[model samples]
Target: MLKGFLHHYYAFGLKVTSDWALPCSQRVQPTFATLEFRKQQAAFFAARVPRALRSQDPARIHYHDLEDGSRYLKWRGVFEFLISPDSQVVFGHSLDGAPAAAFRSYMLGHVFSYALLGFGIETFHATCVVVDGEAIAFLGDSARGKSTLAAAFLADGAELVTDDFLVLGREGKGYIAYPGLPRIKLYRSMSKHLLPARKGQRFTPGRVPKYLYPMEPVTKPQPLRAFYSLVSPDAIKSQTEVRIEALAPRQAYLEITENTFNVRVQTRERLESQFRWATEVVTRVPVKRLSYPRTLKVLPEVIAAVRADLQASR
Candidate 1:
């Protein structure tokens, strides 16, 4: 026995060799058909690499295109990952004594996002909920309450599609939102208030205080019903009422660009494709700005207003 574990991350079945436990909320079998794991021997790079995707000075996180055409990534303190040239498989290596929780966290977030991008699927820094069988996504930067609002929707009986990384693709003439891994990362304060039924576990023991709330995931891709780019708090000055404003096509396109999770890795071809997809998406679907006071007490009102808006759109 290789001593491996099997799980489903988003829609893909993952066979992991790392010493990590799969989420308790989602059902993962003990076996898998397709496997991705770590390399036994580490690879070394030359001092003067000819080609590189992105590299920081301190070299904490870097992407390299090796002579063999594989993609290499290093998350210094966490893990290192390599994506096959064909983008069919991923190889990962967790730092010595690295907790599996931390490995799972970065895998589902940045590493997986990069791999999906390599495979030509676009991901957004957004969270989404299923509203009446379709996906209603909330897009924004960090700390803009994307996850909290998703938890509110989940509390209101909507199934969660994703919490942080939202994968999307085009279906027919409109866009469809793919289901992500069945987990939600919530801060302790928000978890206490929003996720009462589900038990919360720390995302990673020592790194972050956020708790991961695993839930029943919506596995199939759903048609994107609407997209809301949450405005930053400073953008709304003393706003008491929840405001929903339809965004113009240009504005929607810009917001989409900003919220793209792997915008930096986009090549020229990818850039053109994203632009075309975004343009078509904005025309076929509504994109709006959802703004309100960042107060937990008013969350119910905000959720009610969002539902009303969605209903009216339909």
Candidate 2:
């Protein structure tokens, strides 16, 4: 039973359902209650959500509220989310749900999936590279160095496309522009050697994350020309660099599967769909590996190399 309500994301049309009913039944309700709850929640999310969120689309931002009651449930992770082409769903346990972990997996996966689906376009869980009116995406595992590379590029004067995710859209015969959003997580640990940032700068241990320069103006997405993942351990010279090259389809699939956090839940169809997306991305935008080192001094060198490569390709 839901004690709260459901809401939809204004810009993305994400639907979220949650429990609002107090003292909810421990057992699951098959039909009536569930349906009623879903409807009510949906309306709640839709009606209450403002038209503008984080100054972006007000219509696309959606959320849910649950009243599981019983704070003793101690549920830390209790949420779920699902991503389909046209829509997405996010759910969380009521107060009685007991633990966030209960919802972490589902919610996280659904969010990741939504990000991957391109927020209605094609999206990747990585930083974006914008150059020559074009955008390239970097995808990888949590600590694989995508943000480091993006930061590296930024240090070299390239405009930031997006820190984490970007929405792709059609533009003048080619798809372009990153969607919305800002602020990428800089793992305090990883930044130790990756950027010039200092340790204490971060609120806690890990990378010294920072907002993009000229913060007042939001970075816009441009045409996409390439997608790369930082594989770590590329030949290190006095200066590290992002080596861009074409990858065999097999290798691309392998790399994507390896980087995917929820690989097991990815069904054959889902896998195929992902592959199809990857293939399309590869065919249109070259996919490559961005291998570099833990040094901030060499960031410019890496960005320079990418710029040179883009110029050469153009």
Candidate 3:
């Protein structure tokens, strides 16, 4: 199901494939083929991707069309690339075999979103809710309630910028944050908790083998003041207070490097450059580890503390 409003992304053209089989909208949105390949495109993806990933995931067809002279698909990761009549490029995998197109698109999106941020803009996997003009990002692993936390901030009057990713760059000695890409992904369980339970809805779009989700209707991002890592409590007594600690460059590098979208596909030189950017980001921003109780009850307190921390630093 197309969850939110019928929004358009003026920044970039899109080809979407929905599991619910939603019909296309305008010239920009078409759920049909162009003039060439029909199911052959799917075979291309199937032939190129690995058997294991394919078995684990059979591409579900959504959207396929010609745009900007490139045939694009929003597909179910069922088939490997045989000869996707659109591209005729022949998509294939290495020994380890790449993930399906759906998974790879997101990872690729993140890398480019950050790299293309322009003039020091960097993307962070976090939920950014803008409070009083500054963006406070809630970073966490899947099921960590990043969006739930952002929603809490919104209820408390914070504006939503990006639910899953944030772009950070320097405006002066201070930094400026920008929103990159649209769409927020949610798990069925998580979606139920955050967006209200819908009958007969069993899974989210990026469910099963994937953990990342994208959110849209985001506000323009502002400068990043801090970075937080969401982790579970270390001890029973450590429940109430979130363990917000400053992060060193080495630690930030480790976290961002590992979690970056398709960090492995990046060349060695690119990896080093990203690493340097990570360090510069850590040094530029007040990076911290926000170890809080897993429940949503303490969300407000956490946001308040973050707000106060920024105020004090200022």
Candidate 1: which pairs clash?
Answer: none
After TM-score superposition, what is the CA distance of residue 166 in candidate 2 from its true location, in Å? 4.5
Q: For candidate 2, give the lDDT of residue 48.
A: 37
Q: Runs in model 3 with CA error above 4 Å?
A: 1-122, 180-219, 233-238
Task: Assess candidate 3 and give its lDDT.
Answer: 0.49
Residue by residue across 1-314, what tens digits does model 3's lDDT show?
32442322221122332222221222342111221112233455454444444453345532222223332323343322222333322232221333444443443353234223322234556766677777766776556667666656665677666656554555677666655444344454454555453232222343353233333433433666666666644443456776577777788766665544333335465566777777766667766777677666677678788778778778
lDDT of each: 0.74, 0.46, 0.49
Error of 1 at 276 (Å): 2.0
Which one wins by lDDT: 2 or 3?
3
Better of 1 and 3 by lDDT: 1
Index of the highest-lDDT prediction? 1
Kindly report which residue stretches of model 1 are placed more than 4 angstroms away from their true locations once superposed: 1-35, 43-57, 204-208
**Residue 192 deviation, candidate 3, in Å?**
7.2
lDDT of 2 by residue, 1-314 (tens): 43555421111112223333221122221111111112122233333333232122334323322232101111122332222223333222323343443233233333544433433233455667666666767777665667777766655555665655444555565656443332444655444454455332232322544423221113333677866767655334453445666678767666655654334334366666767665555455566766666566656766777777767877
